[model samples]
Target: MRRGDEFAAAIRRGNRAGRPTLVAHLQVREDVAEPPLVGFVVSRAVGGAVVRNRVKRRLRHLMRDRLHRLPRGSLLVVRANPPAASARSEHLAAELDVALDRLLRRRGPDHQARTDGRV
Candidate 1:
């Protein structure tokens, strides 16, 4: 999941949800047996190397609690927006929660149906 290809695939094929501070792309992979894979993208638009690393650290910490909530084998890429550079951790966490909620709800019914082995 650390590779650029993985991030590109998620961005291209996954469902997306966004907030002012962050954007998330998620794709469910049926063949994966491992826990959810999460990646962070903090562009230069967000800040310098120090700032980007800080943002990434904050995101990673926030996502730890949320990993279990994601579908198993899901690929998730969270990109920090420019606004995120000045955003507080709480604000980032709130936005992440909202985005994840929306994304999960959008896929919920279909996922449940598939897991139940029904069309």
Candidate 2:
């Protein structure tokens, strides 16, 4: 989706769950009725435009490969730390996988707990 205020706001409000490779903060709410989609935030602080673009491209590719594996109806905002800015595509992909794995695992248990309680 196009970058907009709502998307940025959701990123700001999202929960902060981190992995050693990457730290992610996501806010999942029903007001957003769509399935899992992601927005990335990389600022000038990360590096020049070229570096930022490279990081974005790498993450986008990783996301394309992993989106189907993700839980539906979630909005994910991935923020890259300084170390990630200069990372190679493979390293970026691996780090993203680690971050996503952590998030999905956390979500799964919480969802199961809630569902089991409701049953």
Report lDDT (CA) for all predictions. 0.86, 0.66
Best by TM-score: 1
Q: List ranges where model 2 is wrong by over 4 Å.
A: 3-5, 19-21, 30-33, 110-119
CA RMSD per model (angstroms): 3.5, 4.6
Most lDDT-accurate candidate: 1
What lDDT tens digits, residue by residue, belong to model 1 across residues 40-111? Answer: 999999999999999999999999888777877788999999999999989999999999888888886757
- Runs with alpha carbons beyond 4 Å of true place in candidate 1: 110-119
* Local accuracy of candidate 2 as per-residue lDDT tens digits, 24-94: 65555544446666788778877999988887777778888776654445667877777777677788777
What TM-score does model 1 achieve against the real structure?
0.89
Error of 2 at 75 (Å): 0.5
